[model samples]
Target: MMTTALSPEHSGDETPKVKDYSPTSYITHSNFEFCGYSLKIARTLSASLGVSAYVWEAGIALCRYFEKEKISFAGKKVIELGSGTGIVGILAALLGGNVTITDKPTILEQIKNNVSTNIPPACRHRLKVRPLTWGQDHTNFPTDYDFILGSDIVYSLVSQPSLIETLRHLSNQGATIYLSSEFRTGNGSLPFHEVLLPDYFNCQVVDRLMGKDITVYKMTKISTDPADGL
Candidate 1:
């Protein structure tokens, strides 16, 4: 049934199925179960694509959060940013949200493959994939998306401005942004909380034991309007 510990049996012993043409390739498959639904995800290993080719812990945590919150995606319009391995978006699709899962143009095929493999044909109509480079023109994308989902996307300082801008551009007033990032010890981690976040969205640090390193934040767009009576 449902188990946090992964078993080799869960990874299906079938011969590695070819999904693409990468000169040298390595692949792994895993299963995740939540709310009585199971999803099979395949990951392709690539030196160039780096971590974008695999599912990260933050993604798993977000899935767990969705299950815990009893989030029903039925009829909801959702967008997932940097949807590596497409785990979270697939989970959303299974829950019934009409979801757009996006990443760099180079990464879209892998995500598409994942979506094709895991999501059933009936539920597949609800999922879409697109190339989205944050902080750029997203005029073609929906601005009134009911929910924006991101996981482990706050790792870079260079991208923070565009990230925030993209967030503002995608979210309509009062829409919630759910972002999960691990609390890294060094590098640009602290800036997200200490520096960059204060300048953009109003953030609430979720106080649950998501291990010591991982923290999930619920963010809402901060008003830019001058005070009526503040």
Candidate 2:
């Protein structure tokens, strides 16, 4: 799978290129094959919408890892955060997970469209789209998920703390979390890995796509009480 980026600043049919990445302005849709099903994702481009309308490399990489490892989401209760195009969460549903796909309220419609396009009528009941703005709307969800998924969500340092907080809130002791991120200089990803996340969860790098500079992490919550150590 090829990686794509969005340059939301430019407009009017002229595609602005970002380094080795292609801007999503000219690309209205993307296609992918996962779990033996072909997925056609519709994309919208606007200076205001930014990254939420496009599928990032990290999201695709995570989907590839799932198929490669034959990861089982069968019968699992799953939720995906920052579900931009809803690709990752949609795949989880296809793998038999009862899934909730979420992003900011503005992006929820796009995700809902993708879910409807890809998931068949029979499996439609297995997935739902909801609005989730990290730390703010986490209470609306229950802490009983079997797995939590995210991709390319840790772009801003300002949002990392809240994202970590939401992750902690949504996961129970038995829940597992999976996050995939692209490596970029000066991005919040480093601090998230080194500082914020370690305080709340035990994380391990379960997969790496070295060529793409993306890594997928598996995390489980750490006990909050000091007494647990004793």
Candidate 3:
């Protein structure tokens, strides 16, 4: 949300100069209720911060899915990828999951702040915010996660391969992965699940929000047989 503030110079030539603006000046907060708790989330309107700074509809859809389905993450090792605003992961922690909320290095600070705003001091130990850049940082995390969550993360075809690789790296055979995305034309999100994912994981549509163009997919790693094609 970087806006250019132009101030006219007093010189003979009427020229405008740029005024510096603080990034925090563009931040706004929103409150959402989940698990009987009111969570306040801060979002930066700066486009430079990228789409991760705003809360997408898909994220809220996933949150509702969690409540409607009564999916239990209690005592589970959970991680959320591309956790913009950390809403989904925060809700999971409130529901009793030991959760890790992650995004790229530049966005980690925002997620950390959101985690602090929502999670109470005593229960804050259940949540952690860390930097993770898809394929590059996948190795730093363990592969034994019980649940992996993502929302609105599959908009880029260019990043699909790395995203899939990271998902594979973080999940074991027993792990379940939930991803919610808005279906946009030429976004590669639907194809990521229908085409790209079947090779490494078994995926199915677990929920869809009518009229919202958002879908929630539940996936699990497919155990391979070395001799299957031999």
Candidate 2 C-alpha error for residue 96, in Å: 0.3
Error of 2 at 187 (Å): 1.5
Superior candidate under lDDT, 1 versus 2: 2
In the range 51-121, model 1's lDDT, one tens digit per residue, is: 68766666767777888878898898999999978888888888989999999888888889889988889
**Candidate with the larger TM-score of 1 and 3:** 3
Q: Output the lDDT of residue 197, model 3.
A: 93
The residue pairs in collision within model 2 are none
- Per-residue accuracy of model 3 over 30-133 as CA lDDT, tens digit each: 66665566777776656657788677778877887887888888899999999978889999999999999999888888888888888889989888899999
Q: Clashing residue pairs in candidate 3, if any?
A: 1-45, 1-46, 1-47
- Supply every candidate's count of residue pairs whose N, Cα or C atoms clash at under 3 angstroms: 0, 0, 3
What shift in Å separates residue 177 of candidate 1 from its native position after superposition?
A: 0.5
Ranking by lDDT: 2, 3, 1
- After superposition, the stretches of candidate 3 with alpha carbons farther than 4 Å from their true spots are 1-25, 225-230
Error of 3 at 121 (Å): 1.0
Alpha-carbon TM-score of each model against the true structure: 0.86, 0.86, 0.86
Question: Residue 7: error of model 2 in Å?
Answer: 11
